[model samples]
Target chain A: MSILKKLPSKARLEQVKKLSSEIFGSTWNPNNIRNGSKILRAPLKGPELVNYYGVNDSMPTFQDFKKWFPELKLVDPREAYRVKMVEDRKKRNKGAPKKKKE
Target chain B: MPFRFPVKFDIPKHAYVNARVLRDQFKRIQYADNEVTRNALRYLARNTELPAKVRLEAQLQLTSMPKYTSYSQIKNRCVATGHARSVISDFKLNRTAFRERARAGLIPGVTKASW
Candidate 1:
């Protein structure tokens, strides 16, 4: 069974959202709200989340998530943010021109 | 009886496709370069299945020195020999050579020790 399937639901989401707001220094938007809810409903395995979310291998743990959302069982946003940043950088590089051939 | 009107969001199909493509390509490139920026490009390339030439071009253009190297070392290497571009080209041709050269500090502004 998928790890995400085993996670807590509704109540957990509320807690996580509250935490996300504090850590991100911004209010949660629809997209992240949906994502955060999904994460709470079924917390994906680290690697699976990385693959699906385009996160890095070095992402944070459930404990870190707890620190952020003390109430919900989740992974740390800091780790998630790190992976997201890596993914973002790759996208930025795609349009750049190749180096001049010697 | 109910009359239904379809609602369309402003987000374009190209934007979604582009983002997906970008992420996949970044994933592929990440294995090669392993930096956040490089990895993201790899993810995009892999997802889009961009032509190999285009992907290679992106890799070449975006490649940079590892963080540990000093600016002076990079400048000196450039003046001493036009090896930076060559090393990157070599990396494209032969993966093993790329690794070796990267280890030997042949690529300007990067060192295996740092990696």
Candidate 2:
């Protein structure tokens, strides 16, 4: 889209939360999404003691979910990351002491 | 999307349908321009007896079309969020949205890696 957001915002978050609920509502509980992973033990007397599973369940990384929000106007991370890196480098070097001459 | 000038239409990306329409329209323009250019060149190539004046005129006509009609000028944006950059044409989503939706199981079979 023409208008691209460089950073995440509350509006984007709210939008995706609504979407996650809409898409996953039939299958998952919203409360369980952000609860992180859990271990489920095999039923009855099965030899499989425990099955380690569920990383954020159906929920993706907080920032990663913004991709699905049609109105957020997100930009490519490649360009955003590059711009961030350059800005960071400039900031990091701004206060450095001058090198001594030989 | 932006206004695709010389085509007398705006690329309306505020909404998904409009964006899609714009992209499709530009693609059609691109194809038509290419066909026109190709046919003109073919006529020039096959007509050895054609006068130099007509041949030069055909070449000029081919170059006269706006570059905006070319497909390369068009970019795919995520239909959901209207996000730019790294839009996967197959998925019609930006990288972030694709990963999220795929993880959410909106897209079949593909899942996100937790590690």
Candidate 3:
């Protein structure tokens, strides 16, 4: 007979496994079933993926400048021309209908 | 131009917009918005320890979400021209645009190879 004692019982092995798993902060999955932990382990790609389009850094138009700094009293020449054309059209009675005063 | 509706910031006038680009933008937005919930449900559905009914319910919910919410649907498109094919992700420009810009000295550090 060997000097060493017999192998530990199945229940005792199970207890040891459970305790070790608990101590090590690991999942006690003796059945080796699917836990879907892989999915959680993968980093979330949402924030980076959404920002892939990048920020809009287009040159600010005159209208935008006015919106940002109203005190500057900036006037866009194109807008002035458009308003003048609209006035001309209104004088000729070709403008859009006025909204009803409720 | 990729967005049909107004966003927080103004979209540049030169940004190309088309039906495909519009759809891709929608998918990207949806994916970003629902990614967390989708992953959670996926985890639940795949977990064998969970009750069968709960797992089934999670799967059903996952299926009910829009197909656009999936990341695989997003296709990289040219930011300048909205072309779907041969897009170089580094500059987000298609081959033609990339070649034109590179030759015009628009893209930095890219010179014509004529040795």
**For this target, which candidate reaches the highest lDDT against the unseen true structure?**
3
Clash count list over all predictions: 30, 4, 0
Candidate 2's C-alpha runs over 4 A off are: A1-102, B1-55
The best candidate by DockQ is 3
lDDT of 1 by residue, B1-115 (tens): 2322122112212212243333332332333333444444444344334666776666564455343221122211111222324434323323445576678878677665543
- The residue ranges of model 1 lying beyond 4 angstroms of the native Cα positions read A1-12, A23-102, B1-79, B88-115
What lDDT tens digits, residue by residue, belong to model 1 across residues A31-96?
432222321333222333113223333565455557878667676578799888877877988444
| CAPRI category for model 3 | acceptable
Tell me how far the alpha carbon of residue B87 in candidate 2 is from the true structure, in angstroms, after superposition: 1.1
- The RMSD of every model to the true structure, in order and in angstroms, is 27.0, 29.2, 7.5
lDDT of 2 by residue, A1-102 (tens): 557656669878767877886887532444454211121111221111111011223455434646667588767787799888877877889544667888
C-alpha lDDT (0 to 100) for residue A6 of candidate 1: 75
lDDT of every predicted structure (CA atoms): 0.43, 0.54, 0.82
Estimate the TM-score of every prediction.
0.16, 0.35, 0.62
When 2 and 3 are scored with lDDT, the better candidate is 3
Tens digits of per-residue lDDT, candidate 3, A41-93, equal 78988877665556445455566689999998989888899999999999999
